[model samples]
Target: MAISAKLVKELREKTGAGMMDCKKALEACDGDIEASFDWLREKGIAKSAKKADRIAAEGLSAFAINGNVAAMVEVNSETDFVAKNAEFVALVNTVCEAVAANNPADLEAAKAIEVDGKTLETTIAEASGKIGEKLSLRRIKTFTKDDNEVFGAYSHMGGKMVSIVKLADATEEKAKDIAMHVAAINPKYISQDEIPQAEKDREDAVQTEIMANDPKLANKPEKVLEGIKRGKLNKVFSEWCLLDQEFIKTPKETVAKYLGNSKVLEIARFQVGEGIEKKEENFAEEVAAQMKQ
Candidate 1:
């Protein structure tokens, strides 16, 4: 039984596998196009498994909104080059859409979602094989708001950063402005009230210790020191809390003042590759390895 070039071409078209891989599959399956397709898929799954341990910290953060519901997703690839691929971008969009539509409870649930009749996890595995890298759905989040609330979404640097904000009784423009501010400022909390008591206590202790260490403050009354500590704490909170920070668009007003009658209900921000430790390659070693190959 001979494998024909035509058969290899057909398999490549079907699976997007390389020409050499397609030929190998055709040969292994005795030129049966259907079997060869399956063979290629199996090979791809194997490739994906082999690359699973590789770090894939580079990719995109994308969001999809449907009516009052919005979903944001981060998809990772091994290299920035692959992150820019149209296929990779489309996959990110599809995952975002699926999460928005299905509102899966968790990351695993989102991965188990069906896309074009295939599980999203399986689809990612297949794509990893075709793209010659490990691909993963890093995170998924969804926000839902009632008719009285509005959802604002923004993506920066293509998809390097994404932010979504839910606002109650806010105009669309204001919502988008707040989302853009969140993306730019990277606020830790919506307001001072959202800060945990333990965290506040810790900051107060730190500031009080600083004041005690100061020579001039050593002679100050306890009441004066307490006021100074409060001021310092407020300054720190202004940086960490969104409502206290000056609005990006209007420097004079804080986000709290900018909102006027509206209130920020919830916010989600994703910075691509935020926590993943990327592997640094030695140029000499890389060149030597490539030369060896």
Candidate 2:
């Protein structure tokens, strides 16, 4: 069967594959457009799988702040090259802005929120079709404050990661400083209470194991062991707790004491491309495969 240009164009539009590849597939399928699409899907899926294992650490972290509410997120791509793409960066910014404006609880909800004439999910789909690469909305975290506190936000490594800090009585300068600190230090939780009880229990168990391992502990009293365990627990708590962390700006003081009168509470969250896993590409493998071709 003779292949028509229209069939090849239709297949190319649907699959984002090269024009030559589309024409070949259409010819192979005897000008059956639907079968050509299926053929392309099968080939793309296999090719995409070959690149799935590589780590995608490069992407964009965007921030959207509106009054007392702020949303910051990370959207990762397979390469630093994609991170520099203006369209990808714009998509990331739009998603972050949607997160702040809508305060969606999860990715599904955020994708459903409308932007301009289309929903976020539709926009991402459109981008994917245009860019010929996999694009994703990786993560979204929203923070809201009811008091006079200012929200601080920062993006580091050209948007690969971001951090936001919420201060109850923070001045604009202090808020910005705190945001920078969070981006640098990346504390695990806002406060000690925010740490899960399971985590605390796990730390306590590890402390008990350490105490049991000591030879001198054979003669020491149980009360002394209890005191040692408490000290270990306190150490673990302090390491993970934002307030207990040493202030990045002023290491001389703990975060709790650094901003004394402001009563700073880091209602902050840092997300780096949560849920988006990039398909990895191996240059050597790709070369080998192309050689076979």
Which numbered prediction scores highest in lDDT against the true structure? 1
lDDT string, candidate 1, 131-250, tens digits: 999998999999988988999999999999999999999998999999999999999999888999999999988987888789988788888888888889999989999999999999
**Per-residue C-alpha lDDT of model 2 across residues 1-293, encoded as one tens digit per residue:** 88788887787667665566677678878888888877756555223323334565667888898766788877666667877999888888888888888888887788778899656755665565455555556677788888677887777777766878777776878778777877777778868888899988888888888888888787888898898789889988998877898899789888778777776565555556555554566999999999999
Q: lDDT of each model, Cα atoms only?
A: 0.88, 0.74
What is the Å distance of residue 245 in model 2 from its true position? 1.1
- For model 1, state the Cα shift of residue 9 in Å: 35
lDDT of 1 at 284: 96
Every model's TM-score: 0.83, 0.74
Candidate with the greatest TM-score versus the true structure? 1
What TM-score does model 2 achieve against the real structure?
Answer: 0.74
How many residue pairs in model 1 have overlapping backbones? Answer: 0
Runs in model 1 lying further than 4 Å from the true structure: 1-43, 285-293
Model 1 lDDT on a 0 to 1 scale: 0.88
Instruction: Give the Å shift of residue 140 in candidate 1.
Output: 0.6
* Native-to-model Cα distance after best TM-score fit, residue 209 in candidate 1, in Å: 2.4
